[model samples]
Target: MTVIPSLNVPLLGVAVTPLNRAELLAHIRDAVQEGRQMLVAGHNLHSVYLWYSLPEFRDFYDRAGAVVVDGMPLLALLRIGQRARLRTEHRIGSTDWLDGLADLEGIQRVTLLGGTPAASTAVLRHLRSLGGDVAWQGIPGDPWRAEDVDEVAEEIRAHDPQVLLIGMGMPLQERIADQLAARLDVPVIATVGGALDQLGGTQSLAPRRLGTMGLEWAWRLATDPRRLAGRYLLEPMKLAALLMWRA
Candidate 1:
């Protein structure tokens, strides 16, 4: 097993590994070499809320092989509360690293589950353009549900890919990735929320500069306030109260 050091955050009742993108990919490469099935998941502010609010969500995270720190806020809290040595570069958004998976030495076949047919096509095209021996395939999973787990697993198993990337948002993706990791022999099963859409150009990624400065949430809020205002504004307050109460 590739043992990445993790720090416990009592505030969120979760553990986060401070890994930059290269380190994460190296870990994934090691997992592939060891022939181990690993679920690569991440934690952002929204996931922190779900981690506390939903039992299944918490369970899924508890079982993840790697739970990377994905948001600046969560990274800050981890440093402040845990008194760890995490740096700004430790916050790894999935969009920044998805492309690198194609270059993994032992990975030849990758299957993606999630996004629209068009979006999946776009992602596949981009991955193919990377000029690797990796065979890429995408299955449309826009309306994935709990009942579809078995069928989805079957479809992924049929592809016989070495890597599986689940992009269905949130709890759903985590749910499916957990089940698939248990059912399939894929070396790496990644729960990448919205990464497919962003890679496919269906969703606009926030400017890289904003992300580096920890203001991507502001950009997302500005772009889609109706969908994200509560997530960016109200949820932090709730998370703060939950942390204080737990503290």
Candidate 2:
């Protein structure tokens, strides 16, 4: 059994295990090969509140096979406070990982959910351009309806996609994945917030150098100040609170 170290982040309200990129990839590959259902979560403090406030969202995390760390701040906290033995070398955002996955052949069918129709279309086109044999589907609009859940699940089952990528953002998408997980036997269901926008060209990712330096948040804030100013600016205050609580 591989022992993964748990990070002590009080605000998260759960023991977060640190799995290096390779370990994470291997875990997903093994899960797919074995035909076992898995839920993948990428959550921050705000998203954590979204999960705790919503029962459905909370249940999603509870059922996930793995919830990898995505936020740079979260990684910093883990490294500094938890004394974790993991390297903070790479920031494996779900969108980047999915693109990399697309390059690999004979893996599994991928179903994309969430984002606007236009964004979803771009995602499909990009994946096809990458020579990915993915079976893609998109929600009609931005916010998905509960009624559409079953229909989406039915389509996914018919396609039998090994991986389901939910981009509905935060608690909503995570809740949807949890509900759908109970109804279907899909191998991997990933809740990736705004990744579709990044993949679809509506939004740009931070340059590789910025990402490597853990300043990707700054890049995002620079790109859309009006949209991300409050979220990114206020995140530090929340981090302070978490650190105090841990102390």
Best by TM-score: 1
Off by over 4 Å in 2: 1-6, 10-13, 48-56, 103-106, 139-141, 238-247
lDDT of 2 by residue, 90-151 (tens): 34677657775564444657788878788888888777787765556555438577888788
Candidate 1 C-alpha lDDT tens digits along 109-193: 8899999889989999888998878888899898766787888788878889877998988888887777777787888888998
RMSD of 2: 3.2
List pairs with backbone clashes in candidate 1. none
User: What TM-score goes with each of the models?
Assistant: 0.93, 0.84
- Local accuracy by lDDT, each model: 0.84, 0.70
Candidate 1 local Cα displacement, residue 200, angstroms: 0.8
Residue 232 accuracy (lDDT) in model 2:
79
Q: Number of clashes in every candidate structure?
A: 0, 0
Instruction: Name the lDDT of candidate 1.
Output: 0.84
lDDT of 2 at 190: 82
